[model samples]
Target: MRFKPHFEKIRFIFGAIVVVTISGCFQIFGSGPATFIKKSFNPSKTKQAILFWKGGNATSGNSLQVSIKGAGDDLDKAEVGNVFTVDDDHGKARLNPKAIRLIWKSDRQLNIEYDVNLRTFIQLKRFNDDTIVYRTFKPVIPANHMD
Candidate 1:
């Protein structure tokens, strides 16, 4: 499945919940006739555990191979303690910073904080083995930025 970048970038859109269940009903008769039947598929046959990466909806196993572009505009996966460059080059000066300390807030959420002469921010989702699966990146400001 292809993932399209979100307008706001990598935001989880928890939309309506659609449950699809398929079960059958059986009828039984007493003294007049004997109708013995077995019924299965009672519980929901569909898996409802779903995740969204850049507007692409996938189940737990459906997005096992998903990928996304990093803040450096390079498509990569975020693992623990991984550092990468996000330096910027202006006409006069250049700012070099590294994105590090990849932490998984949850099984499906990740928070990556970086720097560039100042601290920056990036967030993504993890599908399998804590791999980032969403795109769209910008400098994430902290609670205080004047320091």
Candidate 2:
């Protein structure tokens, strides 16, 4: 009877440690909530483009993800079809809708424009049948010079 109480305490401590470890892993690996930034439809309105910001912890920083989906696809059910990732060292200045511009030149062509300083982690030249083109202002300073 005396040993039973001690065993129960040990089990509780072990369970708590396991839970804390799992939660810490999630914080390190998983991103925080995604905030919708902007959306645009193709000229034909058959397909849609979405831009959102996925918040991250201090280690991961914030990221901008661009996705394409059907016009009628549910925003909640659709996974983030991340075609481009703007990795500006987790800078949140570009979280606004105006920060990233998306212009559909035609049903098959898309023009994306953003700051030249922002490094693109993933830049797809094409998404499905749409040809993607990126435009940026000439960097006055070399990329390596930027802190």
Candidate 3:
């Protein structure tokens, strides 16, 4: 009777809902913890040093923090705004609006790194790929430290 039609309709809607719900859950919780890989820099003809922290471990709920250190000169006084570039391996450098901190540590070399969620970096729309590239001008180390 008419009961068959009603049952079919209900089943279709239920199936659709289940499919959508599962897909959403995968998008939300599928990605696991973020893994940060350290990149090494070589002092060569390149005045600016570029390092990238892979975003495989990045999720959709955290902010990307860029920390700079080992600059013998106070970065606050230097033109540091346009100093670095973050790309996605596709030739795009995105900027993070979060606070950038400059600290002076007695380290042998300059190191800069950041932790950012995939969602935050994706908002920039600068990268069509998944990886995020960070490029910065060579940290101004003391001449005495130069090899």
| Residue 107 of model 3, lDDT score | 29
Clash count, candidate 2: 0
**Model-by-model lDDT, in order?**
0.26, 0.73, 0.33
Task: Look at candidate 3 and tell me the lDDT of residue 67.
Answer: 23
Candidates sorted by TM-score, descending order?
A: 2, 3, 1
lDDT of 1 by residue, 1-147 (tens): 245666334443322111112111111111112111111111232111211111111221111111222322322222111222222222111222222223344444444443333221223344334444333234455323454
**For candidate 2, what is the lDDT?**
0.73
Write down the RMSD of all candidates, one decimal each.
Answer: 25.9, 4.2, 15.3
Q: Which of the two candidates, 1 or 3, achieves a greater TM-score against the reference?
A: 3
**Would you estimate the TM-scores of all the predictions?**
0.20, 0.78, 0.30
Best by TM-score: 2
Identify the superior model by lDDT, candidate 1 or candidate 2. Answer: 2
Query: Candidate 3 residues 1-147, lDDT tens each?
Result: 999999999999999999999888776654333222222222432222222232322243232323232323222321222223233323122323221222212222333333231223322212222122432332233212425
lDDT of 2 by residue, 45-101 (tens): 998778888776757766777887788864552244457778564442344455568
- The weakest ten consecutive residues by lDDT in model 3 span 123-132
Off by over 4 Å in 2: 77-81, 90-94, 138-147
